[model samples]
Target: MTSLLLYFLLGIISAIIGALPLGAVNLAVIRATTTQTILNAFYIILTAGVGEILLATLALYYNIELSHFFTQHPWVQGSFIFTFFFIGIYLLFIKNKINTKNYPKLHTSKLITGFSLATLNPPVAIYWILAISWIDKYIFELTPHTSFVSLLLFFFGIYLGKTTTLYCYGLWGHKIAQQKNSKTKLSRILGVALIILSIFQGIKFIAE
Candidate 1:
């Protein structure tokens, strides 16, 4: 019981610290909250948390092997590049305004959108690997079972933290939407940001 409590506490702290930084997943959550219901935003955060757990698990168990594989795999790099570009194009070309009253239902389910967006992001996997390495070096010992439990709790904390942050952003968005004709402005800003992220991803891919 003591061991479990310690691990769980560590998990929460680590995940909260890690998630404080802004990133693509954070942006997506904010976007979802702005356009969809808070429940839908939670769905996005839940799936993203699941993705984090999977990545952290893989990092804990097979860090060295996976690192080598990712380094060697051109296809993996290509896939990331293509995915970013595709998403960027899609967002950039989105003509319809994303107002709550007239928000068109997306073809993709929120669950799938959240999962795929989080999972396909190469940085998340790399971040997990690095985070695991740090935890192994500085924190508690990581046996197979302990690593699993700890990371599970950690990602749960991440989900909670992320949800909180996105909800705040959602409220901010809601305020803006209530102002004179701001939904279109918000959508345009998000679209441009995604496009910029895509460009950065492409450059990073080439540099790597």
Candidate 2:
């Protein structure tokens, strides 16, 4: 009842916080809005939301197993480090890799790109795993024992919050596109920002 709704609202808040950050998926949404139509941006947003909620659901259901797995294999953490470093280097040193002009067809179908971008980001996956654990201890006690209906409500809230936040990012991208009309420059700036963010996170992971 009321307790179930609390899980829903917590899921929304957690999702908004997670989605607000600059990640590959948010950048994809921005790129779609800038290069393609808002409708295309929505397409990406929808798939991205699906991907995130899937991850969140997995995290919710297997929180204990996942935590145990990470504890058992510390080297798995280095995988995350490598991924962040690779993305940061590719974005910063590489020459306009995301340049949509070079691959116009790629932008035409944002569905796969959106899902790939969302699910493949190591940082996002780690965020969900860590977020669920932290929330279980500090915010709310989520466990496999939690009711299935409560988990469903939380998953729904995650989907709603993720798409809404990404739509807002699309709107911001559209505004910048209308004003600047320089997709390359905007993309490069966001790319650099993402690199900085990724590296910072990677370092944090190592330090932890």
Candidate 3:
């Protein structure tokens, strides 16, 4: 019972930390809520959570090997840096060509959008790898049985945290969409945040 509680807590904490940052997934969720229905946004977040679960499972299974590999090939970090940088630049500079007047019909299906977005983002994989490493170092002993049970709890927590956070963002975005010229402002804010995060990650990579 204590081990279960500890694993659950670790999952909750790690997931909250991972999702707290403003990233493509959160921004996408917010945007979906703003332009579409909250239900649609929920679907998107749910699918993204599924993706995270898969990644977390894989990371737990190969924690030691992945940690060693990441340590040896630091260039893999560059994928995360470049992805965020590109997204920041695109969001900051690229003008939206889509007509907002047709927003109802313009959006893609939430499940597909979420799955594709999560799959394409390398940072999510990196996050899981680091999370597993942290768990191994500071959390409970990760024997085969413990690892399976702990990671199962951890992924469940991740899904809960992610869905909760995105739901909050969805609600906030839905509210904010009622204001005048709010979407543009939100886009700019997300863009800047992504750029800042990219730089932060770059520095952390170098320091490590």
* Root-mean-square deviation per candidate: 4.3, 3.0, 3.0
| Cα-based lDDT for every prediction | 0.65, 0.78, 0.76
Clashes (backbone N, CA, C under 3 Å), per candidate, total 0, 0, 0
Alpha-carbon runs more than 4 Å astray in model 2? 68-108
Q: How many angstroms is residue 153 displaced in model 1 relative to the true structure, after the best TM-score fit?
A: 4.1
> Candidate 1 at 75: error in angstroms?
4.3
Model 3 per-residue lDDT at 155? 69
Task: Choose the strongest candidate by lDDT.
Answer: 2
Across 65-179, the per-residue lDDT of candidate 2 in tens digits comes to 7667766776776675566556656655674655555554533468887887787665566678888888789976777777889888888888899999999999999988887
lDDT of 1: 0.65
Q: List the candidate 1 regions with Cα displacement exceeding 4 Å.
A: 1-10, 13-28, 85-108, 143-155, 202-204
lDDT per residue (tens digit) for residues 1-208 in model 3? 7887787777777777777887777888988877777888888898887776776777777777867877888777688787888887776767354456855655578898877776566567778787777677776664356756765776688888777777888898888888888777667767788899999989988887
Candidate 1 lDDT over 26-45, as tens digits, reads: 66776665666667767777
Q: Supply candidate 2's per-residue lDDT for 10.
A: 85
